[model samples]
Target: MDFAIGGMAAVCAGFFTNPLEVIKTRMQLQGELQKKNKQNIRYKNILHAGYQIVRHDGVLALQKGIVPALWVQLIMNGCRLGFYDYGLSRGYCNDKYGNVVFYKSVIVSGCGGVVGHYLSNPFYLIKTQLQSESAKAIAVGHQHHHKGTWKALSHIYFKEGVSTLAVIACAYVE
Candidate 1:
């Protein structure tokens, strides 16, 4: 039960972290030269940056990445907990008294992280592309290419297919 709760917590944590991640990625993708000239860029914190996004784009802007973010989180946490349970039940988490203490399962849990990410890479790649500034900019007036997740995925598959996935996997291997 504790592991189940922990998995749910992980899901929620992933959900909340995504908005800030969206902001951070956008900041990092901006021109370095332009960023270097901005005085406030160095000193501004997450709150300040979030405030700027809200100020310019309103409250709904914070939730731009929430859909894919939630999906990724749910899949990740579900696999993590499921695998942890499997490991524990399979004698991989035996304790001093042959009892499975929760901490003894950390190794299995960490492996679960890697497995979950790899299994879910396509989802995450789409998530990243959806949140990308270039895509967003192109989407401003181009409604045809700006379909929601499922449709956008079909577009990606039609245009790039598994090569897109292979590139992402290669990057991870590197």
Candidate 2:
């Protein structure tokens, strides 16, 4: 199925993009927490942080969040493509000649992204939190942070409710 192709491509994209995503997360967290005003928030600044990481922690440090990121990306992209295909096949999209419009295809795709992100939010949050500078000291030996995915998920649910869906929704929009 074309959906499988899309899913595989997305997985590939996710793998390649994840390192930069980790760097971006770390940079943003660092910038937010530091007292000094950041002169630049450019990609170059992220690269500089990456360089610093390599200097201090070795190249392996650049891949600190790889495990959780891989989990999230694979699940997210797989479900996204699956849901899109489901929606399209269900006639959520229509053919031309007064049947269905292809623009509906875009809508289905967007919906797929939303659903996939929602399903994958806990993994994403954990990956981001794990990768963040602020989380490092606090999460060290912390039971909650070290807990399994389901446990972390239950914790998030207890803390945020369905309103947590808003965060995923916002991410989808962005």
Candidate 3:
């Protein structure tokens, strides 16, 4: 029940925020690895990003990685929230009434988030790549074009390396 509810909530939230995620990823991956040429940025700000994406790539551009994003969010948030609820129920981290203790909950939630994020790291990577990889966006000098989520993971693993995945997973938090 908890997993189901958590999954549903994650799906909703993922869909709602996917465009922001896409914009954020594009922002991060914009400006080449060299000294960032701020003058050459395609998407200036969040609003401008939204407008340009819709205008250039259509409305669906904002939802580029909708599949992988939703999957990652569903799995990550479900596991993290599930673990949190389990900890609270077991009185392991939260107060007796399941109210969160600030530090304890942070620790617990962070641990859960790390594990959950790790589990979904491949898809997360795919999501970032999907959002960032236009004809112009070259990630870390890699030029291989990816087809989809699994392909992106495979490209990162077989072509790139798993260390990349580690960085992505560890960077995320609750």
Pairs clashing within candidate 3: none
What are the Cα lDDT values of the candidates?
0.62, 0.64, 0.74
lDDT of 1 by residue, 1-174 (tens): 534665578768977777777666555544343456632242155676567666665666666656666666766676778778878878888875778767768888777766666656666666666554333322221123334667766777788897876676556534
Better of 2 and 3 by lDDT: 3
Arrange candidates by TM-score, highest first: which order?
3, 1, 2
Best by TM-score: 3
Q: Which candidate would rank higher by lDDT, 1 or 3? A: 3
Give per-residue CA lDDT, model 2, range 18-60, as digits (tens): 7688688766655664545632342247667777666665676
Off by over 4 Å in 2: 1-4, 35-44, 96-100, 133-174
Q: Best lDDT goes to which candidate?
A: 3
Considering summed lDDT, which 10 consecutive residues are worst modelled in model 1?
A: 134-143
Lowest lDDT 10-residue stretch of candidate 2: 134-143
TM-score of every model versus the real structure: 0.68, 0.67, 0.74
